[model samples]
Target: MNLLHANDRPGEYPASYYAATATEGERFAPLKGQVTADVCIIGGGYTGLSAALHCAQAGLSVVLLEAHRVGFGASGRNGGQVGSGQRLEQDALEKLAGKDAAHAMWDMGEEAKQLVRDLAAGMGLPFHAGVAHACYSDAEVAHARRYAEKLERDYGYDRIAPLPDGLIGSAAFKGGDLDMGAGHLHPLNFALGLAKAAAKAGATIYEQSEVHQITHGPRAIVQTGTGRVSCNHVILAGNGYLAGLDQKVAARVMPINNFIVATEPLGADAAGILARNVAVADTKFVVNYWRLSDDKRLLFGGGESYGYRFPDILKTVRKPMLEVYPQLRDVKIDYAWGGTLAITRNRMPCFVRTHPNVVSASGYSGHGVAMATLAGKLLAQTVQGQASGFDVLAALPQPRFPGGAALRWPLLAAAMTWYSMRDRLGI
Candidate 1:
């Protein structure tokens, strides 16, 4: 679990095209001594920084502490696809929450996509608008078509179009759902922009300031290595890094590791290879998602783990990438690394208050990029005396991953293996 101390350090940024393309400017120094604010946020990744941005813009005094540099967690290492929905599909949600609530959930997901696009465009950041779900098999492709059609017919939304297999012939991706409204971008760039915006809006962000302890009272005191922050309200937006902060939230949301590998530049012919420059993810429970970088390198991600330990990320990732694109057998994997995401058993995010003045939000599953951003805004709104939307999210029931904490991993692994086997057998 101590990834930094392992061999991943040398190859962490090994010729990563993203690292070369997006060199973040002016690293924020860590917190020193002690200070106070209206709100103190732990973790400088998406959730923390996004919360800082919204709260600061609302004219609240905010202080953010990061265990490491900004965008150092899953936010910086994700596949960069701006998918428009929850971790669960519409049909699955409808069954869980009923029709009315399910429709509301769908609207929120649409809003999430718009929120990402609006922020990036308004801030003048680079982004593309062609995210999709590429079907791997005929049955999966039919399911995609049915899903898209139902959305259009029942929900009055036509954002998703079914791409015929003929159009995607011989491509790594067969045909699936083509969503023009959804998009992709450089995730680290997006995260850094949010941090900058938050700072500009008067939020104090401290990097390399890890919160080791929390003391809740009239004012919450967040203790870091060299400093402590006392604030009227505290938000735990650390996601997987929230180790032992709150047992209640931690028990409900488990940290699962997922890895991605970036290939060398494939030149102008890359688009010809892909047919369209859209982000594509398959229908498997453990999905494989891939997208072309702005510079034309293929960034492929697939491997996942519920275990606390991280295996050889590069070696583990290569097998999955080659499954769809055996042509890439010769393609050199320049950069390979893993990120930890908080996944609830129900696959829905959890918004529970662990302390009177402190609230915790995690368990976005694989959908944290947008939900984390939205959660930050909602957390700030809740702290500002408006708590309706926050309550709506918090009301969602999340069952603990079956089996107690110790056995959760083995249990999830076994269940996931069964589903993966079913998928392979086309059952």
Candidate 2:
């Protein structure tokens, strides 16, 4: 897909409020020769860095290789909402994984939330908490109602509060489900903080180092352009970037491109428009998620597809934003960018050991920021011989998208088109 070269042009950062406000750090030197470690992690995004952080804390030697730079992929560019739960609701998860397993999964969601906070605190990053979902449609509100009730009754979830439409105070949105625990963050800042923590904890991270091949064994050898590392275990945290890396891992999770656009500063009117200062997302197959940056700019994200091609990010994603809040039509878009995330057909994440010495976790479907951090912890546990938690997660039934490899893209496009159509029509 030429992902490495696609968005490398000058000013690709656009005017993203994140880029403007980020605390830029010294770049890590690229891998130039052979190396070895207790564990070698591919992809230096959140998952790899988190895994490296945990493993390094456990006093295990760790080496991490990044194709570009840390936080260069979706981990850096995401809408920055630390969304709660698995991609699906509690009822659907319980129905699929049975009552006992579902309970375990529910607790894991809370763990994911806590993990982010712990990382922030441990690394001295300012992570302001306040993540909420604004239901843009009446049907979406109904789903949120059912979801909240199911969480309370079946999963013992009590943190969610439903805001009535009248109190929501925005003619733009109908109503919303307020999850005070699920907060917004500056993703790049958070990721850089973690990378620094991991490095300080003794994990060696190399940027511009791509793992091109793997020699499998009890101790697998991870070979990159400039070096090779032999480790007792390997972790694939690349997500969508794993596209051409490994066929087996790539086959299970399809890479889907999602884009986000940022608007000029909205000022104190931010709290006036939202009132509660909570992050918001509408419930739809192709969801519309938006949040106010620390600087008060509207950073909104929408648009998903199997292909990697992205339009003018500002123009492509602006229409979707305006559809929900027509008042935003006149708002000047300052930055627009896109990154790919892996999405399984079931909309549930999968963690699998593709081979005996190697394990991979991807397909968080849009719920990765939290899940990926949790998965990294699980990966550490598995590598340390405490496989119970990791095994339970691996047991989740994740079906591959229907269709042969050659037809997967077309098949997904058709299904997504229909689902989006239904969302638009409220069917």
Candidate 3:
């Protein structure tokens, strides 16, 4: 089944809280005829939109194509937590890519978060600062304290503090680090703002224009259902829904569905769930993350599925939300939705140049909010022959799944089953 249309309708956003409260503007028309540009971007999420804006600002003629509405995918449906570092911790990154490379990667991560903060401030969106790491055990708490100190001493960054009572109203958690620099926002509004900025910067955007094939050459021809865009460069930024685009990138990036639920306005009860206006991410292999919405509702993301079809989202997400806030047992679910996010075996983004003129970035794992935005800026620079940052990200390890794209789902499903069980057993 095609993930593009498997769960959500064509040319429309999912029935998500983000969609209901989306910033109202710019419904881009679909590609109707042949067009030519300096760059053709396939995907309209954060990566593609950011790339379009940056490329257009750099005076490159750009055309961005989206299968459905812009930000209709994970960009809009995400937990909205702007994390501070890469998917892996600094020590892990240092091990994966030498010390120098890891430091550079950390710098890039900082740049990414700042870029998002600046963009949100410019768009007049309120960015609530603080994201706490919710640890469940003494060992995990000790590790988090050490990591925070490492960030301060080794990295020379110090916005994180250790919270003894964790950040949420959950007895399951002991305590963890709270990074005041990392924060949350309305993800859909941010994406819509990016689309507006890209349009203002002269990037041609098309909705309901799914790219079916790319006839690669010096001047690549990216064909959609209705029209085609012939450009000198191609950027595959589809993320989870980027199946059949490039077999090479697809091998390392496997798509999976994650669910979230928004509860009815809790009024005074909201403060009890999250004492501070910040986001909390747990230490589970299948993470349980949550934060209070602007209207005093709890927006919780959790649970996992093994296939193209979404499981009962309200049921899947509420179970975990209640696990954290058992006081919310009788709370009514206002909205529940599922979005596809791609992951790699090592949980790092897969950045690769499939061809000399074509670059693709995806498999952000769960760190897409910051990294995906940065990937777009780097992609624009690479397209313009200034590829220092892009080269660094590309130099990082990009491992292909054992069976590439074909059998990865089944294999990963089996592995996730084992991990989820371990989580249940608290092992």
Candidate 4:
């Protein structure tokens, strides 16, 4: 089944809390005739929108096509945590890609955060600084502290502090590191703001324009159901929602479903759960991430499914939210939704130049909020012939799933089940 239509209707945003509170703009009409541009961007998520904005700013003609509404996918429905560094730690990156490359990647990661802060300025996005990496076990806490120290000593970055006895209020956590540099925001609003910025910069955007095939050549032709975009360059920024548009990306970047739930306004009890009002994400195979919404509702995200269809989102996520904040057991869930996000075998992003003029960036794992935004800028830079940063990301190895596209989902489900059991057994 096509994931685009499996769980949600075409051209409509999911019934998410973000969609409810987001300040949506007028929807752009879908492409119905032949169009041409300097660059054609498929998928109107953070990556595509950012790329469109940057490319337009550079005087390049840009056209962005979204299968549904802007930010309808993971960009709108995520937990909204703008995390620090690559999905893999710096030390691990050092071993995987060497010290010099790892250091370069770290600098790019820092640039990613700064780019978000710069873009969100005066955009009315609910941007906040502070994200606590909560650990369940003492050993895990120690590892976090050591990693923070390594980042300080080796990278000269010291925005992180260890919360040993838990953060300011909760006793459920053993210890964790609070990164003041990283932050959270209203993800959907952020995406919509990017769309507005891109449009204002002269990039033409079309909604409900799903691409069916890309005819690659000297000038790539991106064909939709009702129209086509012939451009010198094409960017595949669809992430998990791209599906079968490209077999190369589909093999390396597998999509998985994650669910989130929002509780009723907690009033004064919000501070009791997270004293600092910072986002908290635990160290589990299936991570439990949560933060208080602007109106004091706890937006908790956890639980995963391997299939194209999502499980009962409310029931699936509520079980884990209560596990983290049992005191909120009676708190009513106001909204619950699920989103599909791409992931690579190594959990790092997959950036590749499938063709000289065709660049595909996806598989951000769970760190898409910041990285995907940066990927767009990098994509624009690559299209402009300044590709050092994009090259670094593309050089990182992204192995395809062993079972290929047909059986990869079952294989991944089995492996994730084993890991989730380990999280429960504490082994």
Reference-based TM-score of each model: 0.93, 0.94, 0.99, 0.98
Q: Roughly what TM-score does model 4 have, to 2 decimal places?
A: 0.98
**Could you tell me the lDDT of residue 63 within candidate 3?**
99
Instruction: Give the alpha carbon lDDT tens digit for every residue of 1-427 in model 4.
Output: 9898999988988888899999957699999999999999999999999999999999999999999999989999999999989999998999999999999999989999999988998576767999999888899999998999999999999999886353535556787889999999999999999999999999999999999999999999999999999999999999999888888888999999999999899999887887776888899988989998999998999999999888888899988777777888888999999999989999989999989899989999999999999999999999999999999998998899889878899999999999999988877
Clashes of 1: 0
Weakest ten-residue segment in model 2 by summed lDDT:
7-16
Off by more than 4 A, model 2: 9-15, 136-139, 164-169
Which parts of model 1 have CA positions greater than 4 angstroms off?
1-16, 164-174
lDDT of 1 by residue, 209-271 (tens): 878899999998999889999899999988876887877887898887898888888887576
Error of 4 at 411 (Å): 0.3
Give a tens-digit lDDT track for model 2, residues 1-427. 4565565542133245666777875488888777888888998778888999999999999998988878877788887788777887777888888878878887888899899988888767766666677776787778888888877787677778887454333576677678877886788888788799889999999888877888888888888887898888898889888866667767778888888888888886666546655677777779888877767787889977666576677776887788866777787888787887788767787788888867788888888888888888888778888778788778887777667667888999998899989877877
By TM-score, the better pick of 1 and 3 is: 3
Residue pairs clashing, model 1: none
For residues 1-427, write the lDDT of model 3, one tens digit per residue.
8999998878888888888888796899999999999999999999999999999999999999999988988999999999998999999999999999999999999999999999999889989999988888999999998898999999999999888463477787878888998999999999999999999999999999999999989999999989999999999999999989898888888899999998889999777788899988999999998888999988899998869999988888888777778888988998999999999878988889999899999999989999999999999999999999988888887777875556778888999999999998999
Relative to the true structure, how large is the alpha-carbon lDDT of every model?
0.79, 0.79, 0.91, 0.91
Lowest summed lDDT window (length 10), candidate 4: 163-172
lDDT of 1: 0.79
